[model samples]
Target: MATTDPLGIAEARSQLGTLVARAVHGHQPTTIRRSTTERAVLISEDDYEELLRARRELEAGHVAEAIAAHDRGERETVTYDDRAALYADLGLPTPGERS
Candidate 1:
């Protein structure tokens, strides 16, 4: 199981790799906090890459196109079962699923 914690700067620096490993194994998100500020996240490489791709697409305005497609019914509505189908179409993994 994944373990998560909010850590101070020193703790984060020391535990970064282990926290990242936990995230990769589908453990709960590890948040590094400094004072009242949230510092960083420990997440899988795949999750990081997915975040990058999504950010890139949003920057390029592809997000608007996807929204438009959904509005126009070109993409099927995201019903419960269709969630995976939608992710599959977008070449993304089901983010919360781990076994």
Candidate 2:
């Protein structure tokens, strides 16, 4: 089946092996669409690890930039008295936010 076609969660359940094969061997990620707005992709572990590594690198770059900006007096410092205050400042309670 074409990966371009959406796979409903129920159908994905029965054909998991095929989906895994497509991802692991073909490097083709399959989207298991659950709803109009929600879905998950089945990708190879290698792909997932690469994505994670890329994200870490990006985050580190951002942090370095933030530090450089701070050193240049281009950033302001604010003190928060509590977790709620800090979270509020950062627009906390983000979707699916974890502790």
Candidate 3:
């Protein structure tokens, strides 16, 4: 079974190779901790990219909802002269641009 518990920094450092192998090959994430509140997770590159992609999709959905609300006059309208500038303001890709 995969362990989700956080490992102490020193122990994690000592077993970095095994930790990385578990994350990559076993598709498991390992949390390393310096303290109770200070921690970081290690995952495969594919998992990291998947997380980024999911976040982008979520942000895009939120932006689309806000735009729809503005169009329906449920929210204050903010006009943009340029589409690129509009997406840039939201830190997203333009309508026709590749994501």
lDDT tens per residue, model 2, 2-21:
48877999999899998899
On residues 12-80, what C-alpha lDDT tens digit does candidate 3 reach at each position? 999999989999999889888889899888899999899888978887797998889889988786689
Arranged by TM-score, best first: 3, 2, 1
What C-alpha root-mean-square deviation, in Å, does candidate 2 show against the real structure?
A: 3.9
Please, what is the TM-score per model?
0.46, 0.74, 0.74
lDDT of 1 by residue, 1-99 (tens): 223456777886887777666778764567777778646666778887887787666544754676788899898765556777866656555557531
lDDT of every predicted structure (CA atoms): 0.67, 0.77, 0.84
Residue 5 lDDT (model 1): 53
lDDT of candidate model 2 versus the reference? 0.77
Q: Which stretches in model 1 have alpha-carbon errors above 4 Å?
A: 1-5, 13-17, 62-99
- Stretch of 10 with least lDDT, candidate 1: 90-99
Clashes of 3: 0
Q: Which candidate wins on TM-score?
A: 3
Error of 3 at 42 (Å): 0.7
Q: Which ten residues in a row have the lowest lDDT in candidate 2?
A: 90-99
